[model samples]
Target: MPTKIEKDSYTGTDTTGHEWDGIKELNTPIPSWWVWVFVASIIFSIVYVILYPAIPLTDSATQGVLGWSQRDTLATELAVRDEGRADITASISEADAAIVEQDHTLRTFALRGGAAAFAENCAPCHGAGGGGRPGYPVLADDDWIWGGTLSAIQETIRVGIRSGHDDERYAEMPAFADMLPQGERIAIAHFVAGLTGKGDPAKAAAGAVPYQDNCASCHGEDGTAVEDTGAPSLNDAIWIYGSDTGSILKQISNPQHGVMPAWEGRLDPVTIKMLAIYVHNLGGGLQEDAGL
Candidate 1:
């Protein structure tokens, strides 16, 4: 039988007619405020489902009554941004690269754009500020294997060195390992290393004759390098391979040839022009006439 409901004598409260060791069970009702709050939450959820995208289907989600979408919002914002940049982009596209450098505003925009592009595309091999890695050339220094003029920099960025592009600037040092005797190679390395004043005097003297006969054609007799042949100066402290005697010897035996990819078709003209401008301003850029 069901337990009978009755009032308890101790506190005048209603209790079910069931007890465990003389303690009766009380039937308490939920608070009205809590019940109403729970009901409100259910109602709010229904309203939200109707107002915004809630249910997902096989191909897409429910398009709510408001018709709002994250993609549309992003597109609208991008359109606004593009509108703002339209004039600047047009100016850059139309103007000659050299003429663009003469305008302060245009030059500033190019520098900023170029820095961003360089960081994204060029910073992997060249350091963040064009400091250069082991095989890469230091862009911020005056010791350019090719020329360092603004036009030169632009052309280099466009076609690249040793790249497969038709107009690429190409140069290669003949590997002397097979052609020259081991003693001659070592002597030449010593002579070349001594050009920077860091080699053994006795070894350098012994190597002088070999160097004059074989290496002097491209790298001038004075070791100052002929820029046209892309021969780097041996007399300078800057060593592309390295400054140590061992490194010089390795280069003499089998030289390292670094290749850079052409950016002409890959990047837009405006971007390439900007990159040239940015690289040119990096501490060691030459004036037009001076570089030529």
Candidate 2:
């Protein structure tokens, strides 16, 4: 028990009758506003518990009187949003991507929507701005291995290359390690490196014959690339692996065959169309009758 209960000199408040050492605690009443607030909080908690989920059960959470949930709220919001976009979505779904591109409004919508989709789905391998990573071709350039026309771009996005789809753009650059002699392949590598005008001249000249015999069938004789064969142009500076001699040699010995997943089944048609439009407008698109 306390030593004594008496009025304190400071502000004349009574002591709690509880003392520790020489100090005594004042038994001051709580402010009326504070007491009211505390009571109100307790009441609010009781009401909230009854009106909203407050307890956890074994299989599920408690179903409160209001029966409201964040899941339901989100579903309602999404429904409203989808309804608002119904007309535009329908128009995009119905129209061909080429036709959609003609309409300024549709093109604008597709570009914005495609950017969002690309960020989530295509940015991992293709890069955020379609700059492309190693083994992935740069989408922002005019060096498309397949083709760069709007229709061609759309088809590639739909079926993909070497993606196991029945209609896939299939082309296999044979590994020359087993087929060709080591010296001959090295000569060819030097020749390919020089095609971009940066390799050893002596080796490149010696490589010309061997390159003609083996590589000219797929990659053009001048290394201009055969689009039908999915061969990349060797004369340009847009090398996927590297522009170095070592990179060329490695590719000749064992090529890195890239695979792009088919978006036909994975994404809806409208989304695929928009993606093709977005990629085409990345400064690589060509006129329908234009040569690569």
Top model by lDDT, which number?
Answer: 2
Report clash pairs, candidate 2: none
TM-score of each: 0.85, 0.94
Query: Which residue pairs clash within candidate 1?
Result: none
Give the clash count for each candidate.
0, 0
Give the Cα error of residue 107 in candidate 1, in Å: 1.8
RMSD of 2: 1.7
Q: How much does each candidate deviate from the true structure in C-alpha RMSD?
A: 3.5, 1.7
Native-to-model Cα distance after best TM-score fit, residue 264 in candidate 1, in Å? 0.8
- The per-model lDDT (C-alpha) reads 0.88, 0.89
Tens digit of per-residue lDDT, candidate 1, span 1-292: 3277887677787886677776678766679999999999999999988988889999999988988889999999999998998999889889988878889999999999999999988989989899999888888998777888888989999998899999999989989999999988888888888887887878888899989998899998989887688788888878778988899999999999998999999999999999998998888888889853
Q: How accurate locally is residue 290 in candidate 2, as Cα lDDT from 0 to 100?
A: 95
Candidate 1 shows a clash count of 0
